[model samples]
Target: MLHTSLYCRSFPSPSHLRSLVLSSRLFPSVAVRTSPTLSLRRSRANRSIAMAATEDNRIKRIASSIRVIPDWPKPGVMFQDITTLLLDPLAFKDSIDLFVERYKDKGITVVAGVEARGFIFGPPIALAIGAKFVPMRKPNKLPGEVISEEYSLEYGTDVMEMHVGAVQSGDRVLVIDDLIATGGTLCAAIRLLERVGAEVVESACVIELPELKGRERLGDRPLFVLIKAKGV
Candidate 1:
């Protein structure tokens, strides 16, 4: 089904053949054989296009389903609410699929979710990624011996705690939160994970407030946001 030009030249000396093998090892990917075939190239191109379209559709659906509240907790703050999206089965299913696709093979041993809202999305992500789910709660909320981290918030200072034995040493963890504001709560979660000798593979959120500079406090870590708010 494919045809490629094969040039036959004079046989190379033993030393030259060894050098040629060395070159193949040096640039393995580039050295892969390519058979000239229009149909094969077209198939590859079509696969790429289909993948891009699927991803685009997923993003569009998620962005559209997210409803905007002019002032949720207070005036002057437009809250991006995901309850509407969760209510729709299709949208919620897609949301879970997206998270699973991103981290399924990333060696996630546990998923740590912040208190309250994070619980809604955390369990499913853990199941999809084949990892255990651990809840980080407010002070005195967890019934067991917890490793706690204290951080300052916009309203005041608060602390979040996690059970000490929930995650094991060197375990890979993924932190999930519904939204990113000042990153105070998330920073505390990260501290607790490290204190227990767990490595946080990444942090993800459905929405992010970029104007708040939450990413700055996270330091050089992989932070992923499905959508970004317009401004502060």
Candidate 2:
């Protein structure tokens, strides 16, 4: 199914062969022995390249599993839909595995999921790492006394609320959501967590809309995302 062509050239003598090999950057070590440090560096570089290729493959599979709907809810809106991804067991598991393996030993005590979509990915990650899952709801949807932060939306502004004791002071937290667009919702979630003296470890999302420059909106908070795409 695939073919690679090989080209050959003649070397008049052994000296000519050595000169040709030395002249080519690809055959740097062919003509002479390399230092141990140089050999180690080359080995590390090769391993890194192989690891990067594997990561790229995983990203492609997760991206392909998602569905894109054009002009969704309103015209001019390209929605990155993940319900299709959830239906594919392998893709969905792989997506979650990336997050779980990264934070399993990071000492994340609380995993906060933002509103509706966050509810989907947060629990499994928390369960995997033995962390508690807390829901950051909207308005008075959460019972009892709640902390609220109003964030700017594309159209207007909305409030995100959290229960009084969901996250304790000095608790380490990892914020979770399905996607990050303008980053308003995630920033609000961060504000709520910090107001209680909790340490916002990092934020994680499955998809990101780089065109919106949302990652820049988070300031110093580290935002980890799997797939980067436009109009999503």
Candidate 3:
């Protein structure tokens, strides 16, 4: 005698039963399916969300206290003057915090700021991260045995100097600059650091000019920029 229990499935119809059996046999490994276009759309949506989050964080951190000056350094150069950002208490603090956060994990033995403008941001980051502050000065600025590297600027050429004994062998350094145009100054700073037996772990800047490919001269060294201007 056969024992029929509730577990025994009842067939809907002969034709329906046959169709189900044929489908199962033909495609036994079939799983959930979605069109390729749908998958692409989902991936794009995820990327957009990530990008938006990054942009929002940047906006909140970047000081809107900057002033725009029409051609103070040169004609037709709209300088994005940051004197206001420097004066404001909160903005200045935020700038230092951002730099410190970016380079905290870079194992920086020293923070080297290039020339005049770099002096503003570099020492603060060095203090915050517990690293020694090193200065990259102009020609004849520091009175000691020095190493110098020269490179061209947008309008002319300039040389940067550093004290020979500023960085010890096997030390890791981070170079900071206000802006990177053709990257001449930044490259010189890298060479100066390396000349004294220090390894430049990374370079940080406030702005990058992509059109000029300012970063290309340094090969694959890590670079970070807080903002990029238009046409770059």
The candidate scoring highest on TM-score is 1
- Candidates 1 and 2 compared: the better one by lDDT is 2
**Candidate 2 clashes between residue pairs 3 or more apart in a chain or in different chains:** none
TM agreement with the true structure for every prediction: 0.81, 0.78, 0.71
Residue 83 of model 3, lDDT score: 79
Model 1 agreement with the true structure over 1-232: per-residue lDDT tens digits: 0111111123257675555556765534324355679769989999999988997898788888988888667887888888998988887787778888899999999999988878989999998878999999999988889888899988889999988899999999999998898888899899889998999999999889888889998999789888887433
Location of the lowest summed lDDT over 10 successive residues in candidate 2:
1-10
lDDT of 2 by residue, 7-90 (tens): 114555778777766675754434556799999999999999997897778788899999999999788879999999999998
Candidate 3 residue runs with Cα over 4 Å from true position? 1-58, 61-63
| Ten-residue stretch with the least lDDT total in model 3 | 1-10
Local distance difference test, each candidate: 0.84, 0.90, 0.78
Candidate 3 lDDT tens digits, 44-142: 999999867866565465637666677767776667666777777776676676788778887888999998879989988998888998889988889
Each model's RMSD to truth, in Å? 10.3, 9.8, 8.3
Higher lDDT: candidate 2 or 3? 2
Candidates 1 and 3, the one with greater TM-score: 1
Error of 3 at 223 (Å): 1.0
Instruction: Evaluate model 1: give its lDDT.
Output: 0.84
Best candidate (score: lDDT): 2
Pairs in steric clash, model 1 = none
